[model samples]
Target chain A: MNESERREAMRRGPLHGPDLTLNMRSDPRFLTGARGLIASVAEKIGLSSTSCAQVALAIDEALCNVIRHGYKKRSDAPIWVMVWVLADEGVGAGLRIVIEDEAEQVDPSKIRGRDLADVRPGGLGVHIIREVMDVAEYEMRSPVGMRLTLVKYDRPSPGVEPAAVGA
Target chain B: MADQPGLNVRMEQVGQAVVVTPEGEIAYTEATQFRQWMRKAHDASPERIVVDLTGIEYMNTPGVATLVEALQSAKKNKYRLVLAGMNTNVRSVFEVARLNTVFEIVQTREDALA
Candidate 1:
């Protein structure tokens, strides 16, 4: 999908309260706008600026990873992001974002952090995804595609825990 | 082989503070320009330095290292470095680096000045 088509796809998705789903056609602009929209939703739902920022950043990195490595240019790849508020006693209640991409399987074994001494710039996407969120999980779906889920602790204020009920 | 777009930096002064805004991706290919902007901001010796990042579209580790080094240089010079206007997409790069804590982040350039 192209930029306008991606935006239209997001618009076409179901919009029930507390959950938002966006679909983008593997476009470069998705990173920029997708991240922004997610943050806005989190903020509107009372996620602190920090937590909202965290989830947005992590998701952006995930999308960037998909574009940079997941598919050949102009392929029929599609990216999906599903987000909802999850209250976890472990994470102090935060936004849970699930990012899915319909691209070739990425060998998780090939994912590695760059050496601090080696000092390069472009290899940090996966590292950032793993570091920026409370929990990062990956799994391979049958037939195709990879799913990445990230959680952010969206506490309204510092040191205060909100009530969380399981989804 | 080097036909990629160049990273761009724009600046504005907030009282004694000078805010440097970088747009587009700041990767290995563009770290030099980022560093140059940071250096220029440092040499200006403003009472405070803030990087307005709402316009920054993407950054990577090498790009991040450049910011860390900038913060260190600012500290050595006894100037407080702050980051403001972080867009969610760009902020993700910092969070992955666990760098959100290392830098003083504010919501707006006005906040940084205040």
Candidate 2:
């Protein structure tokens, strides 16, 4: 899909489940609650336990970036989160989490994970988000701020044996 | 140190080492509290420090960053810092960052003490 088409798909989301929306303050205290909600929603949408945890972690990292870099630790700043359960044809089932913040915007193309060779703190958030989510996209919002959309499709491992029927 | 709502930290001295165990989530919300416990444990001036992560099932980049800071401090001060009892979820973050090779990690706290 082209850039505009992908953006439109993201905007429309999937029609499987009701979208969960949260407009929260940019405070660290809110992260735990948000993580719990995302994990629960991901699980309800048929994501595996591991995928649920990974999706939650990705959302947590995205919010942390908004609070730390975008808002510069300003607790009162506004941050919005929207979660959707995707069931696109051929793509199977998945979860999408979009985080928006009303803070200074930066070039999404320049938001690359730092080199891990240096072994430092503070720069691993982006890497974690990208690694956990199948699709990690960053874009500048109108007026001001940034938006990060992360999607993870449910792909069950074939190596694991299926649960015994009734036993 | 006292425990927060979502995170709790306990520290004890064992032989020549200080073991710090943190329970609950250690993401951005609790990283500062977890770091304070690490600081307190380091302040005791033990020959080694081992962080026992058995009770923690979820940890984010901030949590990993806090441990990294502790590791760097241990290196600068000529002391040993080890991590133990990381669940698969927590360990994956380390593996993704390729920090499994940088820090000393053990399967159990007893192994860390050893």
Candidate 3:
């Protein structure tokens, strides 16, 4: 969607309370606007600027991976993103984002990004998502595609264990 | 080839280095054009190549990959690829990827030119 449409869609939301769902075409141009929307949502929910920026970047990486790996660079593909503020004992109070795509089912077990020590341009998106988010999980849908859920707590939840991948 | 519609890349020669500055978001749509521009910059075969990232507000994996590809080409061509003027947001992308060390990052174009 264009920036105006995306902004208008955001304005139509229950933005302050909780949860905003965005339906966007797979085109990468929308990402610039998408990150802004996410950061706004994150800030509105009382997240610090640093945390909000991290959320935006993490989500950016997630969506980028979806476009590259899930849709295989098809500009016309569909990407559905849902962002919400939630309170969980594990991660405390923070944001939760769910991204869904209609691409072929991907094995979550193999979703690990390459080792950072290797030092490459690609494969860092997944690593960024995992690092910024307290919890990240990928689940295969029954019929097709995959759903990725990522969460970031306000403070580091060192005691809270991360969910196993593909679980 | 026509310049990629969404991305704007400006190039100039400074001493022995070629400086390429790309403005606007470098995402999937502009990936091809960005790559092509990088190839053209390398084709100039200068002793040093500097990419000024100050104008870029947003960049994704494709953008980073394009730079990585340029780094690979720099190695094969025996030229130096230096990145300068990275805004905090764009620089974080490189840091999160642990490429802050792999790349020769400088604070300003002057440093890169030096």
How closely does chain A match the true chain A in each prediction, as TM-score? 0.73, 0.82, 0.79
Error of 3 at B24 (Å): 2.4
Tens-digit lDDT track of model 2 for A26-114: 98889988888999988887788889888888888888888988889999999988887776545446877888888998999899899
Go through the candidates in order and give each one's C-alpha lDDT. 0.70, 0.85, 0.80
Assess the local accuracy of residue A117 in candidate 1 as a C-alpha lDDT between 0 and 100: 44
Give a tens-digit lDDT track for model 1, residues A1-167.
46556333333323454387898877764556787898887787677776776666667667767775777644357888888765444435566677788778866666666753443345666677666665576777557988776666653322223453332
Evaluated at residue B79, the lDDT of candidate 3 is 93
Residue A105 error for model 2, in Å? 0.9
- Once superposed on the true structure, which residue ranges of model 2 sit more than 4 Å away at CA? A1-18, A156-167
Q: Score the docking of each candidate (DockQ).
A: 0.21, 0.87, 0.54
- The global Cα lDDT (0 to 1) of model 3 is 0.80
Q: Say which docking band candidate 2 falls in.
A: high
Model 3 agreement with the true structure over B11-99: per-residue lDDT tens digits: 99998889999887686667788888889888898999999988888776778888988998898889999999998878887888878
DockQ of candidate 1 compared with the true complex = 0.21
Model 3: colliding residue pairs:
none
**DockQ ranking, high to low:** 2, 3, 1
